[model samples]
Target: MKWVTYDAGSGPRTGILDGPTVRGLGAGVTLLSLLGDDGERLAEAGAAARTAPTEVRPLDEVRLLAPIPRPPSIRDGLCFLDHLRGCYRAMGRGGELHPAWSQTPAFYFGNPAAVVGPYDDVPIAPGCELFDFELEIGAVIGRGGRDLHPDTAEEHIVGYTFYNDWTARDHQLRDMAQGIGMGKAKDSAITLGPALVTADELEPYRSDGRLHLEVSATVNGREVSRGTLAAMDWTFGELLAYLSRGTDLLPGDVIGSGTVPGGCLLEHVDTPDMAGFSGWLRPGDVVSLQGPALGHTRQTVRPAPPMIPLRTGC
Candidate 1:
């Protein structure tokens, strides 16, 4: 079942997607709360939503928010090394993978407060010139655990959703140049929604323990990049294991599989004969992403809001 948080004239409510229709769940039954008790409650809620006949509405009639709009936290992992290779090539740098990459799944914490609905407008980070979008798949944590084993981490994942890791390339490179971090660059916005497809529903595509879904991105209805989920160097289970090594995992915590190969504009910029690419995004550009299992959503780019002046020469 595809679980979602939507508003149909009665405030945000939990709903289950059944084709082009949405069935509202019991009041106060949120997707995050269903992650408790090792998914026992989620199972009950799914069953109840299926049988309840009231509150049924067309999918397009409701406003969709991120399944877990504001998860407790988010950890985005660089599981696709090819994406790094492409970036390095564009930057005139070496394309060799760091040896440590094989030993660990590197990840960075994201701003949960910046999370936005899948279809909401995306504002250009103030002062940002080169904006990009990362096409990724996000796994939602269901059961909390510490130092979980990769083989057993599967028990903790409740569902999957499309993740659009919007980026301000100029801001990121500037921060990384200082050898410090990439927070302010990425904290602008991260899109999640359509619906969180329950893990069981996607089992058929699981191969060698990794989900293999074809993912693609489009700008103003033109396809920009495409790749498969199976291309990741590590599985979601492995990522969970690595992230949980030092702390406890919590329900509603999101795990993002970083940009797929050729999944963002930065990787394509400066390529041979790069026409139709404006080098960066402009206001009114619509960006969208999706996979076969995941529903599609689009957001138009909006000019950044007024910037806060910094204290200078104090």
Candidate 2:
């Protein structure tokens, strides 16, 4: 079942998206609430909620929010080969690409509270010339446990969703230059959702030919980045296993599988060799991503305040 978090005339509520309608999930509003419980309980609750008479609303009419407005924890991994290669090449160290990254999933914390939904306005900070978009797949955790084995990692994932890890490259590079961690107040980079597709529902798509999902990003109507899910070096299971090693995996925790090759303008634009690449995403740009049965979302970029100087002497 496709679950969504949306605002009806009454307020925010969790619902099952059916065709063009959404059936409310009682007072248990927000998808995070359902995710807070284990998958079994979620399944039971969802079954019951379906049969109850609900104020079904037009899916397009209701205001859509991120499936989980505030994920309990957000851990993103840089485990994609395309992204790795692109980053290394940008640093003039293309030969330094590590094929053994599957053994060590590099990750960073993201702001869970900053997530916006499908058609939401992605505010672009002013005085920034390096707006970018990253097409990624995010795994939603359904249970809490530690030291999970890669073999059993699938058990911990309840579903998956599409994410656009939007970024401001100028500010990001500034932080990178100082040798500071990547999470330097980049609280606004994360965006995702149309709805969450359960693991069982998308399992068939995980296999070879069927796993072919196209990801494309557009600035205005022109395409900037395009790639396939098949390009990922490490499977989602490997990332789960690697992450659960030293930490407890809790319900509602989101793990973004980094970005695919050619997933953003930074991959091509930053290089003088690719000088002809057009301008990066800017205000009024509309970025969209679409997959086979997973649906798509178009978000308009809005102008935002300039990036504040990094605070020190705290």
Best by TM-score: 1
Over the stretch 92-120, how does candidate 2's per-residue lDDT look in tens digits? 77636554675577878888777888889
In terms of lDDT, which candidate is strongest?
A: 1
What value of lDDT does candidate 1 attain over all alpha carbons?
0.88
Tens digits of per-residue lDDT for model 1, 177-247: 88766767898999998899989999988888778888899998878889988999888889999899989
By summed lDDT, the worst window of 10 consecutive residues in model 1 runs over 305-314
Reference-based lDDT, each prediction: 0.88, 0.75
Backbone clashes in model 2, listed as residue pairs: none
TM-score per model over all chains: 0.96, 0.89
Candidate 2 clashes: the total is 0
